[model samples]
Target chain A: MTTTVCGRCKSSGAVTDHQGRQDGAVVWTILRCPTCNFSWRDSEPARAIDPAARSVDFAVDADDLQRYPKILQQ
Target chain B: MNDLPNRARSISSLRDFLELLEDSGQAITWSDPVMPEPGVRNIAVAASRDANGAPAIVFDNITGYPGKRLAVGVHGSWDNIALLLGRPKGTTIRELFFEIAGRWGDQEAQISFVPEAQAPVHECRLEQDINLYDVLPVYRINEYDGGFYIGKASVASRDPLDPDNFGKQNVGIYRLQIQGPDSFTLMTIPSHDMGRQIMAAEREGVPLKIAVMLGNHPGLAVFAATPIGYEESEYSYASAMMGAPIRLTKSGNGIDILADSEIVIEAELQLGERELEGPFGEFPGSYSGVRKAPIFKVTAVSHRRDPIFENIYIGRGWTEHDTLIGLHTSAPIYAQLRQSFPEVTAVNALYQHGLTGIISVKNRMAGFAKTVALRALSTPHGVMYLKNLIMVDADVDPFDLNQVMWALSTRTRADDIIVLPNMPAVPIDPSAVIPGKGHRLIIDATSYLPPDPVGEAHLVTPPTGDEIDALSKRIREMQLGALS
Candidate 1:
């Protein structure tokens, strides 16, 4: 039961795997715009990095435009 | 007279800001042989320290753009702010925000009308079937950027549905994706105030007409894009910031346009249901994925005499987005916290891909630390991406990462920090459910030293600026002597 299409291409098109990884974690994140059918990914950005630190961590859930609600921490 | 942004006065028609890159006494021009083909184009927005310890950016001569005015530093530095305010930039951000957010005694927009004269945007006007690729300087910044997005573009539009809301033209700075001839979409973040307004208009079946302001003084563009209170308008705020009303005119369809705007792209947002907006480099030095956002449809275009289009490179700390949006928003947050935490020092809207924020605070008491943290996290801004919050003593400048790290190393501890994991999270964040929301941690690193040792911070930090400058001078002199 595939609920959502492949996020990168946005065509409901998908292969088994993909590319672009950071620190062995899947670096490229694919998402499909529900309305426009335009598909894109959260890929590696290009502005200068600190040189020391390779990348900043992106909370997979921190994706909502507004305060995408997180489960309150105790 | 001031014409387009970053452009020299009195030019012919529209040009890209990249044409104006001045040689920094270098041997040869670095960027050449690279035309803005589909993949080889990139604009580097760099922030380095000026003589006065303020930040300045350099727009390196882009490869493909020859004789185009390059936008070096549009986020006007402190000195530039002083020029804008007509007062000293020595006034701290706290003071600036408090003055702006606070009620100025009997302050109002006093209009000085110019009957279509003295305005610079009237240099050349192209109506209908306008091909943006030819007239203005549009760079294909990166290979993956959907296409050449006019990096810096703001919309001046009146609500199409409501005639009364005509005067409410928002200078919405959005990444303009050039779709085709006479077609584009304002790919701004959906949560921006302008986005919400467009959505509301669309709900009632209204077209969002906008006249964009690209490449102006950093003060106008950055401050205008700031999302203040729901009722607050950026134009008015910019006017107040400039110590004068931002002079504007009525463009087509009731849009209040900036008469002094460098480049004015008159257009309307489709305000249709939605479209995928990103994959563009975000300020946090990461690719922000696609989200359903309102796309704009261009109608007409206008500009100052030979206007220079400004572009901001997102994806890192010093990018134009950080200099423009980050500090602009941080000012108000500092103002709001002042009401509760009066002694609050500074708030650093650190761009960790729109994630973390590190604030420097003046500790009033033991419990005051956490209170400051809670107040900051709860402040009404789109701070959903704030993950790491640091509280330092007022002595430390929050803008200085070194000082922040020093506070963390010397004063903060694991036990003294407040961590809220799994809090309201945004999806784009790899750690959150949504990209705009997330867990927040407050690291209270304010010094808790013994009272006696705290007597007047001795020239304690040593003359960092002077020593470094002297050493660099010595090295340069030594090289000169050797050559001689």
Candidate 2:
């Protein structure tokens, strides 16, 4: 898999929990990219996930792959 | 570090100031990794906004630039500013205005010109070729800024005809954006003293040599930002305020730079040179739209060993820019008003980098507040940017925005509010219909105590000092959590 690049700064320093999530899915979590200090909360899924039981990687939402096409490259 | 106490030595240099800060528990060093650009600014903004107005931050570990450091939030709080001004703790804003005014009329203190061999700024000099970005991490504060900006710059230049106001130097704090390896644009209003000096040099077909000093004593920064009259030297005023002569070193360009500056960039501002310069966040909480500005060609870059770059967070209210402009400009405005209205006690230029001035007056005569408002509007300095003048009784604390608003709400009337239309405005004011034209509002918030047995004085009752202190003590002793 190609490394993800932050769309803003165009730096390869972009790291996403979804990159390590076993089940690739999008949820409400912080998406920080590039140079700007802004981090947006992904829209909530139709059903709320058990936040307590969710693993650490749950912060990475796979939906970013489609929403931000440049977030990940093959 | 020098062995002398900062105040005792007269704070002749920036390093002296750093030592002073360290001694007074006003400085904090961050050895952890901090990225340039947004990262440093992010931490600075957060730290400045701390409840107690946290100490100035020094980032020792700049991620890409090893051994290079950056400092910010030096003037982040009133306490810090008071400390630099040599004022006692809990110095009221009114006292600050008086402090500046009381020292303003003193004899122009001396400035010592140190030999080049003794100047630390030239310890490590690069004259032939230098890239500013390579030498220092020019961090970008705003996300959409045109480029990295030198927010804390003291660009010194001499009037081609008159080097000083009868012997005082002219130094100004203007924004400079790094355009190339050795090129930067100076964004200043054409009418400003610095801009006028450049134009004068240009008309003479002579390049204006400017010595841009960075990371100097906070006193120097205040002096640079002050509108110390066209004929007066800001350096003398700084020396007088600091109670000591400032040390200066002549740069390669023959311009005087602060002897103890962390870094000095000597540049030649060419005649008739213009470049697109802004779209950067300004003190007005708005982006100063891009326009043609003077371009400066770098001639030399010099600095002390292990220099620390300093920058200001310029945006909205209560930033270093606001605090400096407020404290620095208030005294002049007070002096200007006191000439006409002696009843004027103090002036607080607050909110939006001194766009508004709250003048507290004792109101010895009828309608004196309105007269003060008129005088302030006509004064040269206040005429430019003071769009609103709120006149309150001396009982009200102009620095306390709440008290000011209460006076306006209780004692003011719509009829009492005077509006002057089509006045000159600061170029950076976003609400201006044009760059330098706008309207002004003069709100007379003073109580109308008519003479000849008309009515009794209105009483404003609040918590007594003893009661307030007891309550504060009780609250302090309480074990409240969360919202406490």
Candidate 3:
């Protein structure tokens, strides 16, 4: 399995899956981080899918997910 | 003034409205190959930023996405909003606000239920091998968005406690982030109608079914984002606004949706499941921090042939979200306030979902303006979002920022500013010290009455007559002649 790192939180457990097709050829791959639940497309810009290039305003820390408030308590 | 027939009211679907916009020179179709990422978003941002008339942009050629279409900036400008309201392109914001306010509770317009075989949205159904990325022209709305979002769809849900009541059914617009092929997360606060229903279902340990309708009639979108009472139906209001019956059909989840919607995804919210949702650029011109939100599992997806995916840019003040929701927000507040206090002249809650409101009222007595402001704060939508309110005299036009500023400068006294602490607030407000609670401010900008200290002040009144109107018309004609 090819290792994938999340772009927003830099988690190493991110999974990549082929999405959509053009002429029976895969057009893009979607990368999703289970830790932070951030998803990005391989076809997106570097700023959107690269941790080092992503905006600081939107950067996520996987550890912060524990402290994030639940909008509705289950 | 050019008096044209109100053709917008007859529009049945997003494509029908797009055709109307194209005929009215309010929309443009780009046939060139455009990248899905920054290219479509960048063009949409430019169109949204155009304070001048910006046309709805339809991109027919997206690289890698064959036979797909995406529409943006459908409600991005005042001119486009005017056209959506069946008015002339140059209709003033105040006129639009009052036009919507005038039809506040007129539910005379009917809704017609159609069979699935007759519904255009059911022309194609995908129940097996559901992949949202393959189905939709999914693209990031902002550079830092967590993922592709369905930001403009009308989400229909019924109250879990009163499922059979049609009036208790709700159609709203909430941001949905795609997480997997058939899974996504929806963010909503408890204050929202959908949020309340979700909370109820979670407490009862029952799955809440929903129908997400995309590319609907323009009027349906307007009402979806509107703040109406829980018992009121968005379809009724949308039909009233359109001056025609809305076509409807039941989804697989048994939720009523617009029959002419380009696409409908039937889903069920997992009762106890929560997932990381946001950190997306919100309407407040700031990124909403990540939060745990409800997860939805899609059961079926239905669409028309070659469906057009509709999306809205919702980053800052002047995007499609503000233009799409501004009049709806203002009209409800104005109607609610007017019902209690007819002295209330107008309400301008067009900024940041009524976080800050400017109200024009006829001051009955010394503290009448304050009373109106207080009542405004208690209005259904105002209770949660009306953080700062400015009260002005009836003579001051609430829609005109220049006149409002002049009133603020001249009529406001230092002691007239009242701040109430620890009030409920919209969670997305960046300035809130606590996420969902903040202080409420009221600036009484009305002139002091007899009981209060009245300093010697003489306000200038502008000259108004038919001669000035004629001269103004002549000057406009001369300016056009000069341009020619």
Highest lDDT: give the candidate number. 3
Which parts of model 1 are misplaced by more than 4 Å? A1-74, B1-34, B37-72, B76-111, B159-168, B271-273, B350-354, B424-431, B447-484
Clashes of 1: 70
Better of 1 and 3 by TM-score: 3
TM-score for candidate 3, residues paired by index:
0.96
Cα lDDT computed for each candidate against the true fold? 0.53, 0.71, 0.86
The better-scoring model by DockQ among 1 and 3 is 3
Worst 10 residues of 2 chain B by lDDT: B1-10
The Cα error of candidate 1 at residue B176, in Å, is 1.9
Q: Once superposed on the true structure, which residue ranges of model 3 sit more than 4 Å away at CA?
A: A20-27, B1-4, B464-484
Worst 10 residues of 3 chain B by lDDT: B1-10
lDDT string for model 1 (B239-318, tens) is: 55544545566665456666666667776766454444545665555565644555666666667654556665555445
Ranking by DockQ: 3, 1, 2
TM-score of the A chain in candidate 1: the value is 0.28
Q: How accurate is candidate 2 locally (lDDT)?
A: 0.71
CAPRI class of candidate 2: incorrect
